[model samples]
Target chain A: MANSSDKQNRLQRLWTWFWSPAAVLSVGFTLIAGFLAGILFWGGFHWSLEMTNTEEFCVSCHTMETNLGEYRETVHYNNHSGVRAICSDCHVPKEWQHKVQAKIVAVKDVYHEAIGSISTPEKYEERRLKMAAAVWKKMKASDSRECRNCHEFEYMDFTIQERRAAAEHQRAIDTGMTCIDCHQGIAHSLPTGYQEEYQKISEALGVPKLGEEMTFSEAKSDEIRTYLDQ
Target chain B: MLQILGMIGANMLSLPGILGLAFGMMTRKWGFAALGGALIGLLEALLFAKFDFSQIDAIEMVISILIGIIACLVGCAIRRKGVLI
Candidate 1:
């Protein structure tokens, strides 16, 4: 009976300890565990984002296959400098928010695929010019936002470039021309008669046909000169 | 390029589901609120997908449901802690 009473006393003490102020630490422990879990979750999310940004993955879709084939033959993919520019290097923005937005825009291809918009190589060929125009528009609108990721105006040494390239690059800087305005088909296979399509777009937009030597219709006219000279 | 668009198109559905969950909780039937919110959120996200392969869309669906659950929890906590009653 004395042993039983001693056992009861021990049990009572144990319960009291369990209910003591120390129980507050459980909340702290839970919060720390939660913070750790959040870190792991973010790691996994960012990992997936990086994984999909690779060249190999970009070329996996049939839509990208043709462009990839063309890219493989290009100087950017295989050059003496050994500096390679992958699909995302020239395409995807460096900022995470813009990258996310750009990736979001890419989802339209799914709808196009669903409707068999360019299921066949022949269909892609037919739509090439329209597609090129769309890309050019975006590039122009963004002022070659992605290209600046690697090539910045401040970083360019025009003297090192070919004489003609250097002169044109300088001229471009003076006139506010973006990289895509002159560098169409730099990385991709140019569609047949893209020049005509470009011309038509140029006429519609009233901009100089990009990459052409300017035949200025209003060459620094007096009013513009006065405004600028001020 | 299209993938980014898909992400936006797919996730926009969460807005509506979140709305449904918020109002559903007012009914005070938590099981119905949670189940209905999650179901609605998942359904809307799937519908907005525009028929894509949607590798990340499942993530979107789960996020909306989680939002619904969170909203429900918040509503309950407020109801309990505050002098609303």
Candidate 2:
């Protein structure tokens, strides 16, 4: 009976100690330390996400490396004209149901990257052109919801400059020029590596000059306005 | 520097543990205190959005420090009172 009573007294003392102010303080300190550790480790997690997002990741084959550097430096990185669409942004639909469809389409890119199919600039350009055409077709059929997510009308309608630019945009569209024709360099800078080849092809095939000549500032103003109106 | 202030502010706004201390003290319930602290931190993150404090200037740093210290004290007091339980 004495031993049992002693054990009960000891257990009660332990329980009180556990719920004391000092114990609470210790727990708080431990939590604070853990929180700081999480913040420190987040950088690595963010870097991994960035690596997976790059176009180069999608085109990892040897043949694609030649053009990878140029693509990295493209206007898509800058997102100047507001129509800047990355490979996934355009190809992948926003809804969960369309995710599988996007993955299936992306498989071709993975195969090309893995199999070293595109050997030359010509081959790469051909594939890019086909992809661009498909994107254009999709844009025409729908509102390009993915692009509009970041470049929304309310977000774009912020300044006096944006408003003046919108008037010029209405005129441009009325003249049969779509947003992409003038804002071609929105995704990639003007005078791309493919420019000379594209010009040569235009001349050879008697294809009318599809792009317009505009200064960067003027182009940016017009693009901003177009986005505001949309 | 502004960056330091920003970081401190971010810590105050995002650190659930700091708020948890107060909640725990107030309620005298550790679990609720932790949950409340976490919820407040998450709410701040969702509403204001979190950015790198290293980009801000010295003024912001001082302000953030003031805010963080006050928050910490309040949280500690609440825990001591055991009102939350």
Candidate 3:
């Protein structure tokens, strides 16, 4: 009985304390301090997020050596304009919400790394098709958003492009086809049977048939044929 | 470069540590303050580190808890002395 009374007394005391007004420090000072702390916290979180987005950070995992080497050979790495698109540029989203979501999802990669899921070259090759399919699915769903960050259809000068390139780009824009549709092997080597894998991913994503989606433009057909032949 | 910068940014002005201080200042109860700081540290470490706990993470958590306790004691002392600032 005495213990129960003591508990009640303690609870009453806590309730009173909770309702009591602050005895020290101005409200303005507390608010300012909280605001400053918020800024610092946000800055720190952003710094860490960007840190994980670096190419160096991506390649730090031994399993990424294969992809890194392949990426190094791509035009994205070495171009005529001396511009470079690093790992994050191609993979991570730039928008705040999507970037945070991508980061959270990427924790699975850390789990895979810890478990050595693709630690060996052979293991990586074995899983390449599945992994590439996942990325292709994401890109297709997002309309190849990362690619459009730099390569916008409106900015392209089809007049100066190769005849075949011009025709293809025009067709892509007309059909609303994204960059990844035909540029799968541009950045990395395509896995064996990638065509079948991609077809499956497309069907699952409810995407229209790739080549049959829209009619091809007839403009510059002869030039495009000659260009392809050459 | 990014790793170094990130470590410096996160470690130097630890959000968890500051939160712990704020919790301590508000409650003026060392046990609650320390518990809150530890819980915050554990959540941050687990989420950010993704269960890849390191010695540095553990040390940071301990430091935050200590900071909470110290801040709570300081708040209690100030209240006892009726020092308004």
In order, candidate lDDTs are 0.64, 0.49, 0.69
The CA lDDT at A185 in model 1 is 73
Better of 1 and 3 by DockQ: 1
If you superpose only chain B onto the true chain B, what TM-score does each candidate give?
0.53, 0.40, 0.49
Please compute DockQ, using alpha carbons, for every candidate against the native two-chain complex. 0.14, 0.03, 0.03
DockQ of 3: 0.03
Q: Model 2 chain B: which ten-residue window has the lowest total lDDT?
A: B48-57
Candidate 2 local Cα displacement, residue A170, angstroms: 5.0
Interface C-alpha root-mean-square deviation, candidates in order: 8.9, 16.3, 9.7
Model 3 / residue A131 / CA error / Å: 0.8
Tens digit per residue, CA lDDT, model 3, B1-85: 3323333234324545455455556664566655765676565555544466642355445544455445445554444344243
Q: Which candidate comes out best when scored by DockQ?
A: 1
lDDT of 2 by residue, B1-85 (tens): 3334334434543443355345445554444544565555544333332354533334433443344445544665555653224
Q: Whose lDDT is greatest here?
A: 3
Candidate 3 positional error at A1, Å: 19
Ranking by lDDT: 3, 1, 2
Error of 2 at A72 (Å): 3.1
Per-residue accuracy of model 2 over A1-230 as CA lDDT, tens digit each: 99999999999998766555664457678779878897877767546545655675645567656444655565554555665556566445554323333444455667666675666767776566554544544443334455654554445443554564665555444453334433334453233333333334334433223455323324454456356334
